[model samples]
Target chain A: MRNLPSSEAGAGPETVDATRRTLLQTGLFGSLLLGAAGATATLSGCTGRTEATAAGYKFLRDADLPFLRALLPGVLGSLLPAAGMERDRLLDDLLHRIDLSGYRLGLPSQKALAQLFDLLNMRLTRRLMAGIGPWEESTPAQVQAFLERWRGSSFAVLNTGYRALIKLVAGSFYGTPAGWAAANYPGPPPGPYQVFNS
Target chain B: MAIDDIYTKGIADGWKVVDASTLKQDQTYEADVAIIGSGAGGGTAAEILSAAGLKVLILEEGPLQTAANFKDMNDARAYGELYQEGAGRATSDGAVAILQGRSVGGTTTVNWTSSFRTPPQTLQYWADTFALKGGGEADMAPWFAQMEERLGISPWAVPPNANNDALKRGADKLGWAAHVIPRNVRGCWNLGYCGLGCPTNAKQSMLVTTIPSALKNGAQLVHHVSVRKLQFSGGKVSGLSAEALGPDGVKRSGVNITVKARHYVLAGGAINNPALLLRSNAPDPHQRIGKRTCIHPVNLSLAMMPEKVEGYYGAPQSVYSDEYQWKHGATGPAGYKIEVAPMQPLLGSVIFGRYGEELKTGMAQLPNMQSMLALLRDGFDEQSPGGSVEIDDSGAPVLHYDFSDYMWDGFRRAYLSMAELQFAAGAKQVMPLHLDSRPYESWEQTRTAIGGLQYRKQRVPVFTAHLMGGCAMGEDEKLTVVDSDARFRHADNLSIIDGSIFPTSIGANPQLSIYGFACKNATKLAGVLKA
Candidate 1:
């Protein structure tokens, strides 16, 4: 059973590397086949904005990256590195993977995800739907409060939005090889993976 | 040693296999039978009909991924390429998650291998209530035996893995009706990677078994082709049109292909089959096309076991308990069958349904996390009439299923039963997969907590891998879409030969039920066509 929604959101590191990595590594989608993170990818590139024009990834807009940026760190604490280049690269990696997953979503689910993220992308809409966010300004505690409120609300739409965000972020964050060590899945099974992982 | 990929050699040996994505121009083909899927029912029927000297052609929307491609054993690759919508398909409202496969072998390529014959009670109910001719326990016995022997179906010979052992131990301790699940596999490594496609060709999935045999027997298999609609000429399907999908399996390449066959078989499983018919605007005088689509609507309970369950390391499912299934009798309020799920990280995390530190705490316990799901038997009564299937703007399938009070009662009971059994099997804590649920330390605590939990949509993470009905069989055309022989009542040349033909839920994993019934019906269809 899923854990009961706990109201306490005060347990994670607050150090956020607000630097948005410019290199939107396309390896997130490719890494899915290997079932591992692009451990080979590094945070070497300097700041320059690049659009995600890859095919099959059409959901997340550039403006939506900030919303995910603020929420992902709060939702995924130490699963991502606390602070540094490793943290920046992993966050960028997580966002790319999340974007890839968003585009692959079915139409109905895509609409739901788009609607939820759209609310998060706009300050006014975020205030109305999520009840306070200019994501960059909102503290992790505030974001946590917003998620908790929606998750616990009786309205089905809020619950739906919360589940969509949580599933996308958590699933993508943990799916990477960086997160596998924390989860204790000792890589792929030694038997057949030897042929490929080698 | 790497296992041999069967299709490559079979194709080299004069077997016809086409990747529609590679088609540079429009093409047309004719066959004695054009089957619109390559799953359990379609594969089984293909083998039988082709063996009977019928030229069979199988049209599949997904790509043909085999053991060679399955060597990675990656969930993302499997879900992205083999599953319906990157493994994120859900109910139209996004309340319930659906795990349906969309590869060459459809769900057979991705399902946990648990083979059971259609229950005697379910068969009897069909005969009594729906006036379904044949398919009784006695009638289907030989067909079941035939398929079982053909697919190497038998009780798992090895000892149950830790995950299954817990289920067995609990059911035994509780004196419940639990037993070893029979599996369709040969040379199984006990490697627990069946859901990611068997890299060793151990699982007797249709991809490795029936489909190959059918191909060898002169059947044509085409992958990456999504059939658009059946071209109706008054009462019969004169033609079928389809669009070719690209390598990604989602976008079409705009290469339209048409098929003409003496007989058309719709084996696209429950949801796809109904949506295909509905999209074509097929005649449904009684509106029985997409009605009563049964999904053994599942609700799960999680356990923190004393020992490392390693739930993902062996046969995903080898033990199941039917204690609560027949407790209220077949016709009473809905009953459920309990089974364990493989602890894939992403699947577990989603069901773990936590975030940040809360999610991490659960992730840290993955080795000890065990999940038990209840397959609720639906469609037997008015309160639990089951869901329906509709198409989206792009004609893609969308399912709409609402939980009933009867189903909720079944969910409450199933959760309590699972928690009790998990505790009996040495779980430290048991929790129903509900939004409001907390880890209860004891069976008594779980009983108290579960009784108070709401069985609403997102509140409980409901899912279904088993889909049935939607084009149910009956002797009366007014109450059913297909006749007892699974032939469409309105279209003389068309047949619905998959799980869609079942009038109600089978109360078990549906692979063998589909295989046996398709084997029997296709043989009959073969004989009739041969005459």
Candidate 2:
């Protein structure tokens, strides 16, 4: 929350780049594996290769990595073209895009990573909104409107980034212990409150 | 007489009460005590002093609004009825924000009715910090008890309204502590329109309570009379000069009224009190009259649920958490009170906004979604006492406030906490109330995403309904406009008994505390007059 106060100052370009790299290296591969595992498991109701990979990553020593791994694949797969690149090829591509060298920088890494994930979620959500249907079926007018809304000054882009991040965090943390602990969440488990449950 | 008798007896007392809009100030008037502004502080003081057989005259700038005339929570009508400028005006920047009341009853007519006595610890701090005397909690206990009884303060025992129930559900789910908020109301129908002048007259605003009592005790009130300046003679307030504005918003010719009084009380609230002093040039070289304005900045966080919440159909706010109120080493401003406030569809639509087909899907599920707000009370900082309310060359009240860095910091923290809480409490998605901002899915993402929020040089939203501490009280004339007794240091015959005299922001709804302090000051002033 201390960083939350001064968060108004625009992050330096170097900091943003470093933060991005750290998120890719630490968070990207695990999140992808988890997403693929959750998707394929929900698809066939069977523990497939994706699920085995996800389970292996989930047992990792670092807390955030497994959660992110489980979260990313589900979120990204939900955003992916249903019948396109092979799951392994997509995961590999995402890993290649990851930049992890910035993790060594002594800045508040957790907060910076949280911010990076939020920005990524915002970008992805905008894509999701714009691509309500398959890209081929989407109208030029709809695409233009989405781009117009998202494009502009750095602040406007950052705002979209933040919203996406919050959505991703909420989605990943939905039923998980880590997410619940982070939120200090107190609500009916997966349902609306019953006034007189007794 | 019973409380209800005062209104009936006021009409019989020959006080010549008239609708504020219909009132045209006479060229002249004379009274023993001329009070400006007729809200909680002024109205209470007028009642106490008049009951003691003092001839009292009360002048209020805004038109009186009765229950019959109050709009039923319609933002537009209510804005015209109670707001200073129809609610679209901005601070120094073009950021749209909310200010206090402008009608005869002042801000009380639009308050949430949350009532609390001044905390004893805060009083002790005030006494020690400002060298104020007789302000300890023990000295103020009787006043608090009296005011609470008069206002009918009670913990809401009625089943939590739907909105409040939602908050409770969320809190229960999160294992956080929450409780029913005590308010100053009797037989409230839970119509959820307190912010727009409750049409049922159930809320204990001064319009229904103090004004009638003061009138019954021989106090005369003239509304729509805009006081321009205080006439000072040898450092004592001799009279006040004012003009009556026509319906066209222009000054009516020859309707100028000069009121002569042995004593004067300035109760024009935080913003206008300092403005009036600056306009009158009442001999202050301290430059501290309008310098330390505090508005507990608040923001809303809306959550999308799977069932119908119909948030606007119940109470405006019902429950809150005090767990974070004194957190963080007890130095920084405490965390926010997560409050349940239902809003009308128009406002809700704006809040939910365009969020892809998911938002459209959410809108279709509107009945299931509920919203709660977080009001953060930031610490007092003297960045800009807010530009003093000054008459432009054309003589209309112009108010300008600069956003301080500390206040902005508080707002950021509040927004982050609210989003995190909503997501935790089973919200499918959390949307910020910012005009162009998108919804967040996770708390971690929200923190990072919000860190990128830049202070727009052009347009941004800064909202505030809590305005306090403009004409602060202190022992030194150089630091504040009023002394410990609420007496103006420069003018022996003048005093300020309102939120304007708050030494610092009290970090809560101020109505009850304002009334308590007003009663305390009035009691002291009564003794001084008799002596």
Best by TM-score: 1
Model 2, residue A92: displacement in angstroms? 59
- Fnat for each model: 0.36, 0.00
Cα lDDT tens digits, model 1, B50-114, are 99999999999889999888988876567667887777878776787888888889899999999
Each candidate structure's TM-score, on Cα atoms with residue i matched to residue i, is 0.91, 0.69
- Give candidate 2 misplaced runs (Cα > 4 Å): A1-198, B1-15, B19-25, B71-73, B248-254, B346-369, B381-391, B394-400, B455-460
Whole-model lDDT values for every prediction: 0.80, 0.59
Task: Give the residue spans of candidate 1 off by over 4 A.
Answer: A1-56, A195-198
DockQ of 2: 0.01
Ten contiguous residues with the weakest lDDT in model 1 chain A: A14-23
Q: How many backbone clashes does candidate 1 have?
A: 2
What is candidate 2's lDDT per residue for B73-169, written digit by digit as tens? 4543565447664333334322324557867678888877777776565576567666777788898899988988988888887777666776777
